[model samples]
Target: MSEAGVSLEMSKGSAPLTPVLSANWGDPRAWKLVNYERRGGYQGLRTALAMSPDEVISLVKDAGLRGRGGAGFPAGLKWSFIPKDNPNPTYLVVNCDESEPGTCKDMPLLMASPHTLVEGAIIASYAVHAKMAFLYVRGEVLHIIRRLQQAVAEAYAAGYLGTDILGSGYDLDIMVHAGAGAYICGEETALLDSLEGRRGQPRLRPPFPAVAGLYASPTVVNNAETISSVPAIVAHGKDWFQAMGTEKSAGFTLYSLSGHVARPGQYEAPLGITLHQLLDISGGMRAGHRLKFFTPGGSSTPMFSAAEIDVPLDYESVAGAGSIPGHQGPAVLRRDHLGGAHRDPLDRVLQARVLRQVHPLPGGHLVAGPDAAQDRGRRGGARRRRQDARRQRPDRRQILLHPGRRRRRMHPRRGEELPGRVRGRLPRRPGMAAAALRAQHGLRPRGLPRRGRGLLR
Candidate 1:
């Protein structure tokens, strides 16, 4: 994180470390509406009903809330963009199509606390004068969709979604719709298209989704996390919500942490938290390992090394770190898999994408070394065939026999350690197992030459 974005904020304010969105996620009955109501769930809707629509939007703005979906647009500010005078019906679309790889917060959230999202959708629709709202979930997670559907039904049964909710004279309805499982539909215009029973494709902007969306009407499309954040901001005052994070990026957010961490689960924390802090509490890396390089936000963001772990994870700080604040949370890669990460066909392909800055290739772009990049399983098959026949392809057999060589061939970027006397250690914290051998065997020069700006690949 840049000094400008977080240093002052850290030194100035006191914040809570407890998880907010995920607090009830561990409860067995969290998915039930009765249990949710018991935990003070529809209160935000009641509070919004008591106040005016404009007041709800204002509260969100004061909370300093931003979108959790790849784009970090402020939720309240985006809500305010809806024109009040339009004759067409205003709509609120809760975009649950979280198709970005490694972005898994919303699905688990719905499975655990589906009512949170349903209530949030209602409050957001009321704020924007949207009588009709839709929870556009991705088609792949059918179970999540079913949970959300049951929650919506519960809301109606409890007088939260149907006519004259809570006797507030504000009638609203929420529908749970599923998309055809296309990642591109996560885009607002494309989502609108898919929601309207059309082909999912990005629409050129001039009339953004706020002005025109589902069924060619005025609409507000927000991320599941972004809309789910609304209920909390409404239930608690803006000041209470603002008390947690940095001045510009306030409140707690659900962070999905996976890959080589002691505790790999959802962590809700104040924005601008450093990975070092997360690692400290997470038991650092799985014993005998430490973070080497990790994608700050999925594969699209820049890969950060151990030296940059102190960078704060807020929007401004991450932007300052020369990477966009990705919607998906961090995917920590440990030094234990250095050479292993590289040889793994998938890891190498993703690394190639991260390594190329200009004219980035599309999702299916191929990397170099076509022959060497042949699937490791295929090479193993060739080795087996060779053993049965003339017993040739000794190099292939060596790779199959040696775990390090096999990992280097399969998972190259994560290719780090292999079992040796020292458990395949290198000179440094995240040193290369192969490099350690080259150095130990005296193959390296007195001063190892720097190559490709410190890139092992």
Candidate 2:
């Protein structure tokens, strides 16, 4: 039997079919709900809904499905992580934040088959006992957001979502949330924090969200592709799912070929497929551009040179190649003649601020304190009294006042001159010339020359 539910029917001399996920991507309306339903979509949900949640989990576990979100943890094991006795609501969060520099599969999948995702969401939620699900998509993709919203509406209308889904007594609500476009937010905990209307930054993971997540409830977070793969597992039996790929890694995965590739797009094949095989199917590298380097997953994953292209796309095999297969795709980077590279100036200033924060003050305090505030005020008053006496002191300009504290070497543009503070030789800007000066010294202006002819004079 073929891996994907359908059997491989090859023509006289043609290669076997590449399977359904990617086979019809080129179709104009490939993303339309009608086209997907016609192609045997939602069959998995119907099969999944009929089975008990434990049975569904067992099927996926036996199928050998692993997390497709870089970590490659067993999907079944992840679902099992949710506490059975938790009284709080359980959640299924779809990590659609495809912001990994080279990872593009989630966005395309959402663009093409929004319902496939909705269906998977329902099935996954059912298996994990989640009453609600959240699709955390990257904010940059407005088009995808609009498409998904419409898809959710369609699913609700069709009784695939909301209460009493297909008379199975399972109720699910899916909310498509657009993130504020932060890369760190893709980290599961950070994604939750951002979802809760806080800054997107990684939180210490020990609670791991499986125990305390999203509003402090048990949450099962899986990548979009991982969840999307559920429908097939549900429709097809576990043995059928296990028929494809290697022992550790089973099922078909979508590989996104981008950058220098001739036909760059999603390629659906069993997990262990090699990069060479993908290149062959996608029509290989562009005309004359040779692959100099490539990222196995995205920028976050260590970069891999062309020497490792033959590595299997599976997590184990790719890990052996000294790079994590965060996503099974080749972000080919070819040599090109471009303008000079310039670093962001704000980065330097931020670095300096961080360094200063880490350094110990004169009194051995790692941070400035109230004493520093009094000292700053006293120094300011003394400086004003001795204005003519300290004309030659260039260091007099370096005082900064923050909330409840003050420090020397203030940021050059922080506009920190207190009411009694004496003026210094630093070029003044409105509000905070000292902070601006510090930023300028840190090359915070991206090497651009500051305005005004006074410096030239």
Candidate 3:
């Protein structure tokens, strides 16, 4: 095993913080190729170059490395999906378009150590037999783009890239592409379309990227952190990588901590670490404030309240806790941050955007039931009777605002119980919930081509 040059910090029996991708971030001039190589950087690529591509793919497969991107798909399995018999050239595309709100990990990683991704892309491309790879970054991030370009240039100069890399017969070329700052290109298929100079919108699936991708050839698209993780896995071996995270979601990853916290930045740790633990280690919330709500992944993931601080920040655990673990990291918001009278107008706008981006509503099961309509009518009738009784008493009741009380109400005609956090937050009218259900069921048809035949060219 090669030296990792990373140090793990632990406090007695508390949760430990393991830094791999971010290990050298604090080092002086860490982005330079010379500085990166001095710290056991491209040793993974060296080790990978010695093995057959299949063996390399199998190594990563056994390591249990999941994608750091929002979906958390298995990384090695994605690589193996490329068809061996296909005559078309294979390609590897790294998604550096960190356009999602609160997704801060990739841009910082590129700025701090662009070579990590460069080396990883080369290794991944080799594994999938891709001769070309593209780093599609958001065009608005000019500094990140320049840094990646410099890193690619340095890799070529050092013979870690280009033809006949490091005395091995394998050859690869990495191109840094700057996308026109479209948020939708963060989606893999849409990113591919944008890479080909088309409108950035999601392409239909089934013939997924592995089957038909960039230029209609086979491609393996991975997030920046997902690809950057490859180098350490190659150098350190499967067992070493698997030893850090849980059995299913193995390996260390960078978590971007921001919003209403004392220390907000990137904290690399094993999967399954809790938000409570993260907040504790990061100096907790801002002074005199308490955690109100947070997005476990980003605004794209469902909101988890302060009650869910202990939820494990892993793929399965976070999903189990009603949120998604992703590279967007946890954006913590305290009570005062949202409820203060002096809150900035920009903050209000951001809150609205966050609400809009949260993962789509829970399925129709929340409102659909055999006797749902009947049960809702009965409840509404009982409430009306009680109101009539109160009105006849001639007693005036003082209405007081209770912050702890449920502020919103559900539709009167719906009976099924919703999740605790979502219980009374919907509209109280009779048909709103049903309308939402209709909209949910209509989503599929909306996504289908309007021609009513098949996918349009």
Candidate 4:
């Protein structure tokens, strides 16, 4: 598991955690400029402002920084793709619309430390020679939006944003846009469409975002985490950033560990770290439970069995294992989570519907009020009289008792055919309906109460 560039020997027993973006997450009020500046924040932007844009791009390219946005495209190469001879203005768009299930690292990062993103955006824009930048965030996360807005406002006030930033004579402005909660907007072209006041949809490639994007000009759309890592690369040398991860995949990244684990949250580690190491760092799965399967990235990505738990979770390794490292968040599902030894929650919810159709409540009453119950009883008594009269008739008893000839009625609420007929071979007594249901479905009272009082009696 130990690669050439990765440093796994630093830890005594467990894997080493290199928290670059998540370094100040534990600090109190780390989102504010005061706290962030205390921890050497904006130093990267200051360093970036001193160097030429081409040099900055070369530095990132040399660092081997790949886009954290699923595709793992080279970030510096993407920046270098902008047509310098084009007459139109260049723009940078940060993709923060993390609507994918389990890809929750961006929201928390924005909530905890918005300035890191702000500084990174400034450096990224400067490197790409983009005068205007947009930080496109998920509209559903209003709190994160407000936090990011405040952080950007602080940056502008501190002379890190606007014209002549830190006396470098570089002009750049960042706008925080709130998207209307569309998952498709996570795509770069769809995001560009939404930013332009139209319905979010993907555009045809050919003239991509780098060539003609964001108002028909050259644009660079990078993931939130991808742009956030730029400040660190600029602050620290390329060699320092390259030393953490593998030869191809360099730098530390946020790995969101969720579900069935004892410690479920973002664990910022270097690339090429395996799930076994992550599990050891996170305190493993829940007590008395074992891992069954886990998604390598988000829910859309293919799931990996427990046998592949030790596969290195880098871009190449995860892809080689037949799954994308989408958002780098692994949702761990335990054996018990599959509802094998346990009653599925959906069944428990529908059990009441089964009871409503099969058995009336105590005292021959429906779930309705006493008045409705009395009315139902009157109607039921009339039906019972008719049924008894029919039972006395010759052919009725023979046909009702005949297993093959018994008629089945479809449930009114649920369009499924009930087992036999509700009035026929099925139970009529209260609480017996549950037993009959269990018998018909071959379902056990896995989640039943201690006294055998539950969804399935």
When sorted by TM-score, best at the front, the candidate numbers are: 3, 1, 4, 2
lDDT of 4: 0.73
Tens-digit lDDT track of model 4 for 1-457: 1222323442223236888899899999999999999999998988888899999999999998999988899999999999999999999999999966667899999999999999989988998889999999989999999999999999999998899889998999999999986666787777887898766655545468998898889999999999999999999989888878776788788998888888899989888888877888667877876888777786545567788987888988988887778889988887755322211221222132321222212223122111233324535787744653444321121100111111122111246344565555645532335434544564431222111123233
Which window of 10 residues has the lowest lDDT sum in candidate 3?
397-406
Rank candidates by lDDT, best first. 4, 3, 1, 2
Evaluate model 3: give its lDDT.
Answer: 0.72
What CA root-mean-square deviation does each model show from the true structure? 16.4, 15.8, 11.5, 18.8
Q: Tens digits of per-residue lDDT for model 1 on 1-457? A: 1212333334126442556778788787899998898889999988999999999989898888998886688899999999888898999998899865556788888889999999899999999999999999999999998899899998899899899989988999899998875655776776787787765644434457787777667899999988888888898898887777777777777777777887777777788777776666555667656678765665445556778888888888877876656764777777755334432532333232322111111121122222333445435677644443352221121100112222232221454443344543343312233434544444431122322123334
The clash count for each model shown is 26, 14, 0, 0
Q: lDDT tens digits, residues 350-380, model 2?
A: 1323212222111122211223334355346
- Per-candidate TM vs. native? 0.73, 0.70, 0.74, 0.72
- Pick the winner on lDDT between candidates 1 and 3: 3
CA-lDDT, candidates in order: 0.69, 0.68, 0.72, 0.73
- Candidate achieving the largest TM-score: 3
* Residue 211 lDDT (model 1): 79
